[model samples]
Target: MNSKPVTRIKKINMYKISIIGYGNLGFHLVNHLSETGHKITQVFTRDKTKTRISKNKIDFIDDLELLRTDADVYFLPVKDDALKEVAKQLSLKGKIVAHCSASVEMKVLKNCTENFGVFYPLQSFSREVEVDFKNIPILIEGVNKETSSVLNDIAASLSNEVIEVNQEQRLAVHVAAVFANNFSNYLFSVAEEILKKENISYKILLPLIEETVRKVKEHAPSKSQTGPAKREDDKTIQKHLKFLSNKKELKNLYTIITDQIKSKK
Candidate 1:
């Protein structure tokens, strides 16, 4: 509920940290933490070649067992499918182990050790894109008090908007995120294809897309809703459907989303 920037009122001594899966979120986290005087001792990735190097010069390891055994904290940023297996293999009795998964329950890491938690970053991560951790909201949940404080501290160090979210709430948020981010991006892909087929520049939609996002920031998304569907303009909706007759899938999506919006209204 505190909408203030991450405040490091008291600096904790740098704990030796290792990140599993040196992908997008992991890469950004390492870079962000490294700049904040946190020591990144090692990085683990299945594909060591793709990992980027920051000034701290992290040592990359391919084998999970060979990772620095003395690491005080281990961040598992790996995919959902690999989380349990990795946790099972790792001997983290005394280490603080946290994962970045939104859907997976904290209990999945029970196989690893009692000191486990969720350190979910509620943002879309892409290797090609640069992320600003200051703006990204972090959701953290720890199995124990000590682990929770440590994870909360780590999250607070990276982002201003850090909150303690339980597994149920985090999973619900993940579902909403799928609709808001993934499905919306898929709609843009549909728009891009439509423009490509009609020999129009996709750049033309940039302003409208940007404005939609901007408006949502200022107003509730439902209240900021516009277009034929929001207004229940059947004539305009029919016209738009006619324009999309060639794309069956897109037309269906438009119809379904429009119907849902109308029903909500």
Candidate 2:
């Protein structure tokens, strides 16, 4: 493959940008991009009510055909399944089309436009909480040299780490991310439930949680792991299981995850 470094755009002029979706990722992306001096010319959402806040700044287009063709880049931050179909219908020719889905390959844009690439932001986004773009990592993948350069420049302007990734490698990283982020959050949710049942405030786990994450930053996860599971203390494991007797599902999950961790060791 091509190993050339992508060129960076020194100055960002007024370029018409269209965000196709208004979901969690899309909404936050528009807000983030807007703060970086990039103009959001239009925002297309299935529901008109979602555009209530940005109605003045962005022209909400319901009809796909009515979408302004003057946009320099079309950022599709929609779900994975709807991406290709939406691209096909829009038929955005002579414009750059990029997607934020981590698992989606660059080939998905072949039917819509030649100037296509991946503009994946490595962060967990939610409508409730605002994201800091400066701390987030942006991974970009482009079909051609020019498109790659343009996306790299755009990403670099907003984030500290901007790197080019291929489709296969991106998918792999995305899979790893699910385990690292999503699965870990689920574990926290389980812990919260357990604490609530015991008439204990979840705040009590905050320091332990913070320290666990901090330790991982300094040492490998395996090396930093503590508790009965890591020490192979069967008596302690049995006591924990006995304590969680009322919650069979959580007990099983804890046992399974602990077993996996032990095997890894």
Model number with the top TM-score: 1
RMSD of each: 4.6, 6.2
Per-residue lDDT of model 1, residues 154-179, tens digit only: 88788889989888899999999999
**How close is every model to the real structure, measured as TM-score?**
0.90, 0.87
Cα lDDT tens digits for candidate 2, 1-265: 8889999866754456888999988888788787787888888898888888662477788778888888899899999999878878878777899988999887788877889999999988888887888888899999999789888877887888988999888888899899998998998899889889889888888899999999999999878889888889999999999999988899999899889878977
Highest lDDT among the candidates is held by which one? 1
lDDT of 1: 0.86
